[model samples]
Target: MKKSLFAPIFASALVLGLSACGATAETAEGDTATAVEAAQPAVYADLGGEPTGPVYRMAKADTLAVSGFDVVSYFTGDGVPVEGSEEFTVRYQGYDYRFASEDNAKAFIEDPAKYAPAYGGYCAWAIGANDALAPGDPNVYKIVDGTLYLNFSEDVATRWNKDIPGFIEKADVNYPTHTPDEHYQD
Candidate 1:
């Protein structure tokens, strides 16, 4: 897998993911890190200003989710994600996701959870192995058991492949504990 050329830009746009990730880590003394350490994402849709914890990559109030990639494309055609269009956007749960075309957008609306990334688009390896939050690179990902899972980068993806099922098992338990209550579960 290749790293996203716009990783830095996407990181800036989705600082919420980093902030939520940073907030979940515990120090050796059992104290937790605060969201103050990093920029926070704006709370949107039903959050009512509450922190989103470990939801999807969208900046709570921002419209760009999944790095503006078409989630439907991840499951169709060449099975590679393509850039979605502003003209074909869909709001699922709370965040807005774009699609490459109207047909793709419709596909996503029919059943979002089927297309949504596992672990709320956070790094599956980090969540499973460390119970930690790390930015997921849309460019570097894998589909397992029909679920999309992203990693921090190509290097992280390599480490993730070593034990996909084991990490997923760990993440399955870890993710819901950190994610906000308002979001859907799978």
Candidate 2:
């Protein structure tokens, strides 16, 4: 009789242990699904602001995060813009450019969009799709709001074109807390 009673108790304990294990497995699977969703890249609807070739090249190239995009630009000794100017004294970082006359630079300055990059000169697709910040191709940019923007790469930009607004929303979600400035030296 004692043996029969002990067997039932042991069997009950085993059942409880197996149930606990199943619950733990379910919770783990749920957590993994959430992580995978977060990792997906943003797909674009309008392919306007993607990059092509390398926009700027220098010993020091960096990335920045702003409203979900990574903006890239090269700096001179005094932290001046160096990549997109025709004049010898034009600087890229400080947003200064020199022309034969001050008026010419001023005119360009007043409406830098005619010269600056699109989406604030950052990588539009990277920021838009997944709030990512990547180096931009100057050749793949357009001037919007008189500022420059950059892009991650040609491949990303191509995908970005499929859903521009959607990517922008996703990038906005990641921009505020993202690391890595676009123009850090070295």
Candidate 3:
């Protein structure tokens, strides 16, 4: 008898699909769109001006920074935001980061400033545009001068690309103003 190695993988995929379907069906009135929108984790939401020091922009329910994506992989690997595993993790500036490998995690611990995204993982374009704090999509990013900049979306990223240097300058000036201690004041 011939044995297929893909059997387990296929079964796992099927299980995941079925579970996802179950979740979709459980939404009120079969409103998949509303369910999806509600299911999405907000990038950042103001918590009554509560102070968080220098922590990165993370969802209230999220414990990992950059939505648990490996930051080091963006620079060392294919520049694709790969999800990080809990096995290899690090905590910096009140935010936890997961890494694809222990080596990446160690590299981050060695020089966190080198790997952490700019503007505290908030949307770079929004910072430059109006000093607004918006959730940054890890997938929509760029590495300029060894610095990673994330945007709210592809459209916002395109706007930032129009003048990267100019926007960077503006963002640099505006970032400090939006720091947790600075912006979260009454």
Best model number under lDDT = 1
Instruction: Give the alpha carbon lDDT tens digit for every residue of 1-186 in model 1.
Output: 123436655666566675756645455578776544433332222222333445555344344667888888989999988998877777665566778888887877778779978876788998999988777888899999899999989999999999999999999988878855332222
| CA-RMSD of model 2 | 22.4
Residue 153 alpha-carbon offset, candidate 1, angstroms: 0.6
Residue 135 of model 2: what lDDT?
Answer: 56
- What is the lDDT, from 0 to 100, of the residue 84 in candidate 3? 85
The stretch of ten residues in a row with the least summed lDDT in candidate 2 is 61-70
On a 0 to 1 TM-score scale, where does candidate 1 land against the true structure?
0.67
Ranking of all candidate structures by their TM-score, best first: 1, 3, 2
RMSD from true fold, candidate 3:
14.1
Model 2: per-residue lDDT, tens digit, 103-155? 43454444443544543344777666655445566545433333454566667
* Candidate 3: clashing pairs of residues: none
Q: What are the lDDT scores of the predictions, listed in order?
A: 0.73, 0.42, 0.71
Clash count in backbone of candidate 3: 0
Root-mean-square deviation (CA) per prediction:
13.7, 22.4, 14.1
Better of 1 and 2 by lDDT: 1
